[model samples]
Target: MSTRILISGASIAGPALAHWLGRYGFEVTVVELAPALRDGGQDVDFRGRTHLTVLERMGVLDELRALGTGGSPMTFVAADGRRMLHLPAEFAGGDVEVPRGELAQLLYRHSSARAEYVFGDSITALEETPSGVRVAFRYAAPREFDLVIGADGLHSNVRRLAFGPEERYVRHLGYYAATWRLPNDPGLPVGSVGLNVPGRLMSVGASHRDPGRAGAFALFASPELRYDRHDQAQQKALVRAAFAGLGWRVPQVLDSLDAAPELYFDSISRADVPAWSSGRIALVGDAACGATIGGMGTGTGVVAAYVLAGELARARGDHRAAFEGYERLLRGYAQGCQKGGDRTGPFLAPRTATGLRFRNAVLNRRWALDKMLELGKEVSSVELPHYEAELSGMAGREG
Candidate 1:
């Protein structure tokens, strides 16, 4: 019988894993807490050969490329709205950048026919049995699967249930980030424009497809604070408090916060899991090794999902071997990519005036900017095995 695999989270990683696992003849089920596919998120990019290779294997690279956001050039402005520093589009937008929402939807469309997706529900408990895993859900009937995998984000429900509390693995990087959509007033430029003060950054950029809309991406350095993730008002208050007296279109950005339909707010954090698996349960993507932002997290998650699903196929459903192989092959590469996130907050919004000036001065130099870009390419480089070829060979044997 084909292996029955349950994957938690329907974001990039979960759906990508499902696509491969289903292709390998595994019965896949994806569970997500969100009622539906999340729409409208910050643009994510894929750089280097490793990321491109995986997308090519999945057959979604071309589609994504067509939908790519050409790039997002950023202009840092002074309080009076004069350009202080300008960064080319390529600086933030790598080889190919696409809205995260579009990517997630594409993966879902590819896998939905073969994979059973349970939305508006989540895994509440997971019990390991000799033959399989007994699972409990928030809404669905209890069921059993050969294995369970957490493709959930940094604050993964599966991880909390199978591993432990979030505090154990998540480390805040002394900053907070928030993004929301607003009307793209004529005053806002085509690309992003921002005001950066010591420890704070307030930016707004036009939508690639819709000139009528804009996105606000801001960051501020701060110690970890206690707040409800679901409390929109509270999150807005925190943002307001952080940038209380900022100037240069920041007031306008803050004004839109109350009316913004959706808000994505979270601490700039990283997950460091000692082990990616235990017994019948395992983790992939951000749930395993992830940085909240600037960590090449989206690319790493895609690569990790591909590796994990491929290892399972290669192992022929022997999860113990598959899980170990997945972790062994990806642990080092994933951690290496995560190191970039450690510096994201400081690099984007330095804590002191001197630090901020130094960062801008250094980054403004052509050589220094080139070096940083080169480093990004180096960080994204990873060796990927040809899993599709192996899967095809196994199919041939079965045929």
Candidate 2:
């Protein structure tokens, strides 16, 4: 039987789920809110075990390695622009690092030919009946699908329609981040450099190959600030307002903010749902469990895609069984990732001068940093069980 599946969001998780679902004989359709593939953003990486296995299974690992940013180095600079300490290329970016937009493009190219993509459209309503799921799109007619999955990011429309409000599940980590491409490179001596003030951190780094342009991130902790997630002007204004007095090439970077075509600003937040599926609908990726920025968002998205599709195929598209198994296996890991993100927030944004100094001292220690990298590499790649073989093998062994 051909399982008709409607997937919302066309970035990492949506396309990846479509890829595996189609391979298992499911007819998939992906609808993206954006008019086209977003081709600009900061670098995201594949880290922490399960994520690496997904890339290998997708046959894109070598291609990704070829396209790697080549371990961009990062330096910590004083407010006056004096370099305090710089990390070697090895420490800044993990084993694999690529622009978020570039990676999205790669996933889109890999899945678009085999799947249906409706750009500039979104789901307005979703109704799950006994026969199937009745779906209504903002621009398309009402249709039905055997199952519906939301692979959207933190602010997922599908979650709103199927589940209750986002506020019930989302936990704000009390920080915000903004990224944009700088018109001119900051002319840094190495891969990337950051300047830290009392409550803000700004980074400037050229694309390893393309020195003409650079990426900048200005982030800080703020417990009380409200702005529309989709409002670009308002977000840009917020960034400007927050960093008005920050020094060290910030003025130059901020000067180009208005001109950059793909600037992004969002609060660091995570979502934790008791269950990812209800009735005939399921949520994947950030919609179900968002670890925000540091908890390996890219990795979690990719891994979730593989696991969700694999579980459905194994169960012959049985929503109840698949969702239950998925939750049991993935819930703890997702919680751990979210905790990692929370832990990293304090490290990334030290509240006091003493904390910042201590962080720098630890990072400056060559032996300590090397030891950390060695440990990190060891746990970053995890071997995933092949669903088909594992299921049958376990049955046979038990019998």
Q: Report the number of the highest-lDDT candidate.
A: 1
Model 2 residue 172 CA deviation in Å: 1.1
lDDT of 2 by residue, 1-399 (tens): 328999999988999888888776788999999999887767777764577777888878888888888777777789877876777777647779887887898888888777899999999998878889999988898999988999998889999999989898888888888888865554654366788765678887776657787888878878957778778999899988888977778888888888888887888888888889998888998999896777777787788788888888878788788878777777777666666677555766687888888888887888878886786564333345587576567669989
Error of 2 at 329 (Å): 2.0
lDDT of 1 by residue, 86-129 (tens): 88888878889999889999999999988999999988889999
Q: Kindly report which residue stretches of model 2 are placed more than 4 angstroms away from their true locations once superposed.
A: 378-383, 388-399
Top candidate (TM-score): 1
TM-score of 1: 0.97
User: Alpha-carbon error at 28 in model 2, in Å?
Assistant: 0.2
Clashes of 2: 2
| CA RMSD of all predictions | 1.4, 2.8
lDDT of the candidates, in the order given? 0.90, 0.80
- lDDT score of residue 353 within candidate 1: 85
The candidate 2 region of ten consecutive residues with least summed lDDT is: 376-385
